[model samples]
Target: MNRLPRLRGQLFERHEITVEKDIVRARQAVGRAMDGLGAKAIRKTRLVTAASEIFRNGLNYGGGAVALIHCDAGNRMVWVDCIDDGPGIEDMALALRDGYTSGTGLGRGLGGAKRLVDEFDIVSEPGVGTHVRLAGRA
Candidate 1:
C-alpha cells in the first residue's frame, strides 16, 4: 500500500490589485502569512519582495490583477497566484529576461521575482491575460 502525506493546517488569503495601494496591502498580507508559518526574516522579506514585484507587474502591464495566497503548514510552504485580465505578453522569453521592460522602469520585476522564490511559473496569452505563480518554502 502507498502512503500519502498527512494533512495539517492550510491558509488562504486573497487581495485585489487594482491600484498602487493594493500592492502594499498584498505585500503586508504575504508578510503576515510567512510570519505565521514561522518563516525566517530573510525568507519573509524575499517572499514579500517577490509579491510586490508581481503585483506591480500585473497592475502596470496587465491593467489590474488579483492575488491569491496559500499556505500549507504541513509542508511548510507558501505560494501566491497573481491573475490579470489585460493585454498579455507577446514574448514571454523577452519579458522574463533581465532589464527587459515595456515601461519606463529598469525591467527587473519578473526575473527578480523568480529568483526570490523556490518555485515560479508564468503563463500569458497575447490577447487574453497573464497568470504568475510564485512559491517559497519556510
Candidate 2:
C-alpha cells in the first residue's frame, strides 16, 4: 500500500475488513451514509471511488483494515478513514507519484483518491500500518 494520511476524530460508523467481498459493502455503506447526511451526489460518487481504492489497498497490500465513515452536519462535511495493519510503506514519495505502484494496480489509487477529495491525509510506519483520511465539504 502507499503511504496513507492520518486523521483523528470521533467516527460514527465502523466496518471491519476480513475478506474480499467486504469491499462492496464498504463502498455502499459509505455512500449511503454520506447521502443520508445530505452530501451532494458528486461528492458521494467521488468519495465512493476513493473509498474503493482505499479498501482495495487495505485488503490487498495492508492485509486488512477498518473503514470509518462520518458525516458531520454541524461541520457541513463528510469524511472517511481507513486504517490498515500490514507492513507499511517504505518510500512515501514514490507511493504518492503516478504510475509507481508496487502491486498489479495501475498506480492510480492514492493519487486519484487524493484528487477526488477536498482534503487528504496519509500517515504510515514501516513496521506498523497506514492511516488514510479523506474529506469533502458539501
Candidate 3:
C-alpha cells in the first residue's frame, strides 16, 4: 500500500519489458548504471537482482511492463521503476509475505526484492496497475 513517488533524477535508460529478453536488458542496464555510480559489487548485485525480480513479476503477472532507470548523483544512488497495467494485487499485505504466491513461483519475488534493496516502495490499484520502485546506494 505504500505509494511510490514519481520517477526522478537523471533517467539514463528506459526499457520496455515485453519479453524474457527485455528482463535481461533491464538488469544489465541497472548493473551498468550502478557501475557508473561506483557502487560496490555486493550493492550492485543486490540492486540488479531486485530489479530483475520486479521485472519478471511485471512480465509474468502484469502481462508486460516497463523499466525506467534513474541515477541520483547527489545521493549516489541508483533506482528503477517497473510498472505494468495488469490486474492489480488484491491483497497487498498477503502478497508481500514470503511463501504467499498467486503464481507458480516460490512466492519470494516481492519480499526477496525488498530485502535486497536500500529502499522499496510499491503501489497497486485493483483493476488499475502496479508500480514498484527499488533503490540502492552506490
Maximum-lDDT candidate? 3
lDDT of 1 by residue, 5-67 (tens): 222346468899999999999989888889888999999989889989999999998899999
* Tens-place lDDT digits, model 2, residues 1-138: 455443444466788877888888888987887777788798889988998899889999899989988777777677888899889889988998999898988998899899998888888888889988888776
lDDT of 2: 0.83
For 39-107, candidate 3 gives per-residue lDDT tens digits of 999999999999999999999999999899999988999989999999999999999999999999999
Write the candidate numbers in order of decreasing TM-score.
Answer: 3, 1, 2
Assess each prediction's global lDDT (C-alpha) against the native: 0.86, 0.83, 0.94
Task: Please count the clashing residue pairs in each candidate, in the order shown.
Answer: 0, 5, 0
Q: What does the lDDT read for residue 4 in candidate 1?
A: 21
Assess every candidate by TM-score.
0.91, 0.89, 0.96
* Reference-based lDDT, residue 104, model 2: 88
Structure candidate 3, residue pairs in collision: none
For residue 110, give model 3's deviation from the true position in Å: 0.3
- Give the candidate number with the greatest TM-score: 3
